[model samples]
Target: MNSLLITSTEESTGKTAIALALATLASAQGASVGYMKPKGTRLQSNVGKILDEDPMLARDLLDSTDDLAEMEPVIYSPTFIENAIRGQEDPDALRDRVAENFAHLATDRDLMVVEGGGSYTTGGIIGLTDADVANVLDSKVLLVATYREPGDVDDVLAAAESFGDRLGGVLFNAVKDADYDRVSTDVVPFLESRGIPVYGVLPRKRELAGLTVSALAKELGAQLVTPNVPTDGYIERFVVGAMGAEAALSQFRRTKAAAMITGGDRTDIQTAALEAPGITCLLLTGGFQPPGAVVGKAAERGVPILLMQTDTMTTIERAEDVIRSGRTRDEETVASMRELLAAHADVDAILQ
Candidate 1:
């Protein structure tokens, strides 16, 4: 059976989303696809059973019946690092365990898609890093990297150096619009010349990065002030209305869909956000409720008002953390991801 390991240069590079998309695409082509996350981070509790979120998402999306625990061989527990440092955890045994799980999961499968931990070198302390585990599983690496600046190409090259011949290709993800041209023009050629194929270049998609208003409100513990507002819509960016009302309006107008976060006391900024065409919702800080007129206007415009006790800085940070934490639990996101890949990515080459 063929094995493709999806890993990243660092955390939150969208490895799970790309892996699920490519796997879904391959499965559509009539191949038996198996999934695994050798070292499960981003722990969660499902049905009173503790497991990683990525594997659970993959399992549900791929419709695999394999046991979750078996699919994710290693769960990063509270004291996992402490135990590893104290020499209580055996490296060779853990390696064997992961390999054994891969073998079992690979049964009668045409391809196995393994997701590594946070980054390529995530498990270096325990000898379970992506390179280490790939060596044991004999899998080729599909490196998903984010290029905020051109210098990031060096980061990809550095990671590729470690994988050497086993590097299947690189997928430049979440690339900014400004940097996409250089990545497609100069960077792709350099990498391909070095024997590493460039499978895809996906610009940052707000839909893929966005969190629903309802989900954001729930996660932030904010109170919904407006009645019967649509909270199911997604908000891509959360802009802090720290500047003057005029400046804030200009910024808010730029985003196609975003939540304007400001102090509840900043009535000017609040009013401006309400008038802006792109403001999907308003996150008011300091637990202060908006005036009846503001509330009426928000309700009239169908914008949700989420009130929270946390200050502006804290709320902005929390919202960012939520956006950075990607998701594939919803069908809309799944469908859009496939569309993005089909248009921009070489799904056939990568899976082939």
Candidate 2:
């Protein structure tokens, strides 16, 4: 009977990660939890099957018996969005489908964890936004926001107005250590005074954020030129090799466990990256191929070379986006979330 909808202020705010963590936490309390994502946005080829990855992950992780199709009744595909915007798709009808799905999962369940797509405003075109669906399900809302700057406080205030009485609280997740003091001292007090409940402030530790070399290649759709190289290395961050070879080498030296992005033609920079420590993978841009010797050196050093079609700027942006989007997948991340939420969040209140 207790249904909770997990949404966020922006995309890639670890909604799925936090949802999975909360579901497990509730289960540990002897409550039978059911999971559903009424709408999925990150559709991808999961093991050669094209579907929404989030729902599949939730289903597999929870060991639920509900069909994937029923668990996620709607996907925010391009065609679906286009039809919805053109008035061919009905909002209320789609919402009814979501409600129907929830009905199936609610049997003998003590709690239901529903995850919204993209952001709370994702389904606004069809009028089935997170707030809309939450109202339909009569579920309380938990807004998981990432605090990148002080201005992020505005997003929480705006969400409080939208959720109104249904707004359980706001959890400041993925808050970098640098911004911790400011959020705890200044931001938390401001929200609390204005009748907003600040549930948790979780830090962005490297273990929860790093992406494997294999995941980077898979998510980016890049071709791995060196197939025999190490693919499991963690790329904690990425750097662009736009500067001179000496300058770029200096950056590669300081950065640990990173993917170096540069043009394939910049053989000197590529060589420097190979020489530097902790270069897990090399991303070659603009479809250019590095020389045989460069490839040989990379392979010799056990570094994987990925060929990307985008230019330097676009490649950098895409890499950053991938890191943010793929924040949670493996069991390692889920385990880390348990400790994090227990330490910083009011889990008992959030679930109840």
Candidate 3:
């Protein structure tokens, strides 16, 4: 079976998202697509069984028949490193297990998409880095780079150099509107000149990147104050209301589908956010509940109000964590991602 190793320069570059899109496209073209994450770092406990979240998500997205344990194979829990240091886990044996599981999973498949854990250096502790795994599996590398700034090109090039001819290409994702032209003209050509293929340069779509209100509430461990709001509705941007109500309103107005983060006592700011356009939800920090009138207004507007005990900074940090690790599971986000990839990415080149 032909295998493609999907990895990234850093974490949260949408490695799984790109993998799912590619697998979807490949399946549409009649290829039997299989996916596996050799070493799972985002350890999850599914009813006492340890598994990785990415493989679970991929299994559902691809409608694969493989069991979760088979799909992930190697899970690194909080105690894994400690056990390894104490000689409880054998690195060579682990490698063999990963290889065995991969071979079994790839059986009868036309193409297998192997997702690397986190960055290229992620699994070095267990000797299963992205390049190492790719070499072991005899698969080509397709690096997914999240366009943060001009310096990202250098990072991608360095990765390409590390992969050498094993690197199939780079997919530039989450390119902001301001940097689209530069990425298409300068970044793409520079990478190609260095012998790296540019398969796709995808623009940033807030709908695909944002976290839903339900996800935010779960992450913040907050109590929902407003009832019956659409938990699946997403917030594209975050507006922290630390300033005066008037100033905060201006900042909130600039963002579409924003989750307004403010102190619970800031009734002025909370009211202003409710009045603003594209206000998906209100995250009230400091454990203080908004006035009854404010809650009534939010309830009337069908907005979800999450009340948290944490301070503003801590809440913002947690929200960032949620957004960074959030996946495109909802139908709308999945469809949007597939459409974006189909339009921008060279599916024919990717499949081959």
Question: For this target, which candidate reaches the highest lDDT against the unseen true structure?
Answer: 2
Clashing pairs in 1: none
Report model 1's TM-score to 2 decimal places. Answer: 0.86
| Candidate 1 Cα deviation (angstroms), residue 28 | 2.2
Task: Compose the digit string of candidate 1's lDDT tens values, residues 305-324.
Answer: 99999998998887887776
Off by over 4 Å in 3: 85-88, 218-221, 228-233, 237-257, 262-280, 296-303, 309-317, 328-332
What's the true lDDT of residue 285 in model 2? 99
Per-residue CA lDDT of model 3 for 1-352, tens digit only, reads 8999999999887777788888877888888989999878776567987777778778877788897787887777668877877878888998898888889998999999999887988778778889988988899999999887788777887788878878999998888899999989988998888788999998988767777788778766789998676677777668888899898888778778788888999999999998887789999999998999999899888888999899999998877767666643554565677888888988788768
Q: Rate the local accuracy (lDDT) of all candidates.
A: 0.86, 0.87, 0.84
Model 2 agreement with the true structure over 154-254: per-residue lDDT tens digits: 88888788888898988988788899988889998999899988888998867676878888888788999997887988897898999999999998998
Worst 10 residues of 1 by lDDT: 325-334
Worst 10 contiguous positions by lDDT, candidate 2: 323-332
Q: Between the candidate structures 1 and 3, which one is better when assessed by lDDT?
A: 1
Could you give the C-alpha RMSD of every candidate to the true structure, in order shown?
3.0, 3.2, 3.1
* TM-score against native, each model: 0.86, 0.86, 0.86
